[model samples]
Target: MPKRDRSKRTDPTAVMVRIVVADDGTLTVSVDGAPYLPPEFSPPWRRASFPAIVDAISQQTGRTLRVDVIETDGRTITDFYTPRTPRKAEPQTSAAESSVQAASAAEPAPAPRLMQFAGSGMIPGEEVAVAIIIAHAESGPDGIARTLIDSRYLEHSPTGEAVLLGRISATVCVGQPQ
Candidate 1:
């Protein structure tokens, strides 16, 4: 009888975790800096939330693991260390080419820009989504007050339900008034 490979039988620890907070309240967690994949088991590899996985590891290890949260633009984000070491990459494509590929892979097709607004006077959560939007716009210069809304946000707060519509007037001129 042939002996089985023992190395392949053990599950590996994650090396790094990347968390992204969209303009909306949707939080996405990726393992090993891999692209986000739906929570499924068929592929043998799937994306999972950092906190959930950490909790599981803690239970198994019988020790509490600490994670550091880094914030960029007022969002709570964190990364955890894993035992697995990443393999070195072979340079094949130029930076520009890689950028082009990333841009193309991001969206199959571009959609028209649409502006929508939503708000709630009282909510259970810390109102992270609302604060994120205002901070995003405020960080930029004038005339740049727009944010991309995802399907998840729309589903939670529909078009005209917990949202209100209003407009503000401003004037712009190239040169001094004559």
Candidate 2:
């Protein structure tokens, strides 16, 4: 019986290249990453290896790429290369417009009507003081109205039996439509 020859009979398909992509677009390669080509490789060998290279890089780097075949080692060996594309710039608004918008947003708006009141007394019957305040109304675009009102008072009472009352009144700044 004749002994089998294992050296020259090694399958070229047993050798394979695996590829992985880095987050920053770097690519890595390994033998077990892809299937090896058989000894009877064909003309479309480069095309077949192209997908494996892309898959390897994408898996490792986590980036999808439109891969193009740049060069190859020919025959039993395969080599692949990939280049990254630049990102598009975002649209920007003018500084003047932005500032105007910010200023308008920051300014507080007026209310339609506001009223405030306060009163104070000392020692019961001694004396009692009360005050009332009314704020005028303000109008914004589209007939929106707003206003604020405040009032305060102080008093001294000797008998400690004094009573105080306060009220707020508001007047319309803009006349109502007749």
Candidate 3:
């Protein structure tokens, strides 16, 4: 009789935990950028802050974890890491190709100009769907005098053409390799 491979290692997978902390201290924890669970999972911490997550993960993985927070204009990027040895890559497409496939088409699509040409206003909430609304709609500035988006994003999308044609007058910079 053939023996079953009962080891959990047989179906090993990488878990990408993306934590987006809102300006208001609301945390969005996603596994591979999809909704996984709420921060309220912890009964101890005040609203399941970063330390709460670290506690949970430390208990589960038995490894020390560290998180780095960096503030970029209109965005907060966080990097999480541990001293544990990295997992083996799956036998499939490289990370670079797989990552871009979601952001763009298989064929290189023309970038957008003005970048939505989404002018401005604040929906001001946790839903990422707000971006979708901004993508399809343009608004007059709320007069807040703000540069809400990361400019390079506009230069690389179809919105770039719109920005150029409309004479939107926003700076779109292209970074040269060092």
lDDT of 2 at 1: 100
Models 1 onward score TM values of 0.24, 0.17, 0.27
RMSD of 2: 34.7
Give the per-residue lDDT digits (tens) of candidate 1, residues 62-116. 4323343333355454444443334799879999999999998987665534444
- Name the TM-score of candidate 1: 0.24
Q: Lowest lDDT 10-mer window, candidate 3?
A: 161-170
Error of 1 at 143 (Å): 28
Best candidate, lDDT: 3
lDDT of 3 by residue, 91-170 (tens): 78778988887667657755533322332233222111112124222122231112234345644555432221111122
The predicted structure with the larger lDDT, 2 or 3, is 3
Cα lDDT of model 2 by residue, 59-114, tens digit: 65543343322222221223443334557886787999899989999989654342
| C-alpha RMSD (angstroms) for model 3 | 15.7
Top-TM-score candidate index: 3
Error of 3 at 141 (Å): 26
Hey, what RMSD does candidate 1 come out at?
17.5
Using TM-score as the measure, what is the rank order of every candidate, best first? 3, 1, 2
